[model samples]
Target: MSGIVDLTLTYTNDVAGFSKEASKVLDVDGWNASTLTFYSHCGTHMDAPIHFNVSNQTIDEIPVSNFVGKAWVIDARHVGSKGLIKPEHIHQDIKDKFVAGDGLIFWTGWSKYVNTPKYRDELPRISEALALWCIDKKVKMIGVEPPSVADVNNLDEVTKIHQILLKGVVIIEGLTNIDALQTNCVELIALPLKIESGDGAPARVIAIEKYL
Candidate 1:
């Protein structure tokens, strides 16, 4: 499928002193196994309710079915310089694609800048109106290509947006390959690690396009 897209970043260990052996092979000679550990919130991931709510559900507590579903891709690429996704900024065609319980992936074309200072420091944000719109629309979850839907430097907006959406909706961030999707609707499958009582965990996200 030439239109198929893989929207998760390829992870690697960059920290010098952060490497350790997570596993080892005794039967095989010269074999070593290690996991480059880092924060669960890093890389391509989903934000559980517990991520923002002190008393909310964690990664494992959320149902797996909630993370997998049909999704609509809203192309908000024209507002790139502003870094904000407003409700009105969403096209009517894209808006019409929304259905209750469906996943919503905002295509801002920002995932291309992952790890850059601009991506995290001055990344595009989702306005409160947009968050509320998603909630009102009964969207199952919201996914964005940037690290956070809101700018990390803007603490107030970031926290507010999180609280507004995380109350019942899952949030997925740091998605790559979004620019590769052509379908208005695709089957989105994003599964996070079952970290017991963990607020959030990295996830592997992919989209399967359907054609008539």
Candidate 2:
């Protein structure tokens, strides 16, 4: 790892409004106070169990330690667009070094498309084998630069992937500027906005490279 790498994006009221129908800003009776509203799965956000199931826990229910820890950066840029970041993409040596609760950040160079639909349309995804690998590895968290680890158009695969990972490890998606970091171990601190009983929330994710 080298210097600090910012994995979150700048949230703006203009980018994409909260939902398709919800108003981003609330207008008072006559006041001009600035107001913005968004869902938990907004820019650079984390996904809680509740985001998938109504009976699941919310954002505030998450443990703080789950969001901060040592992480491994897996460089899979060689596996280009629409590539499946499988367990094979990860080096055997890297897998051997993973601690039980280490964070795993995959750098597929797919984050270059942030605001464009192509970003979501053509994101590199984690195969079932890789998702199961994280679970078996006891991974504390998994962060990615793309919007998600599953194909956006395929809900079945997305649901399968999320359920497997979200059962234990925290899922941080929509990260940007991760290419700035070196390909090595780094200390990650990604704490989301403490929204009470909220399914998810945007987070400020940063990494500090260790000096060996």
- Say which candidate scores most in TM-score: 1
User: What are the lDDT figures for the candidates, one per model?
Assistant: 0.80, 0.82
Off by over 4 Å in 1: 1-4, 15-30
Clashes in model 1: which pairs?
7-176, 83-124, 83-125
Per-residue lDDT tens digits for candidate 1, residues 59-140, read 9999999988888888888778556688897678867766789988888888766656667776778999989988898889
Q: Kindly report which residue stretches of model 2 are placed more than 4 angstroms away from their true locations once superposed.
A: 18-33
Which digits, one per residue and each the tens of the lDDT, describe model 2 over residues 95-212? Answer: 8888899988898877777778878888898999999999998999899888788887998888889888888889998887777876578888899889988888888999888732
lDDT of 2 at 202: 82
Model 1's TM-score against the true structure: 0.89
How far residue 174's Cα lies from its native spot in candidate 1, in Å, is: 0.1
Backbone atom clashes (below 3 Å) for every candidate = 3, 0
Cα RMSD for candidates in order: 2.7, 3.8
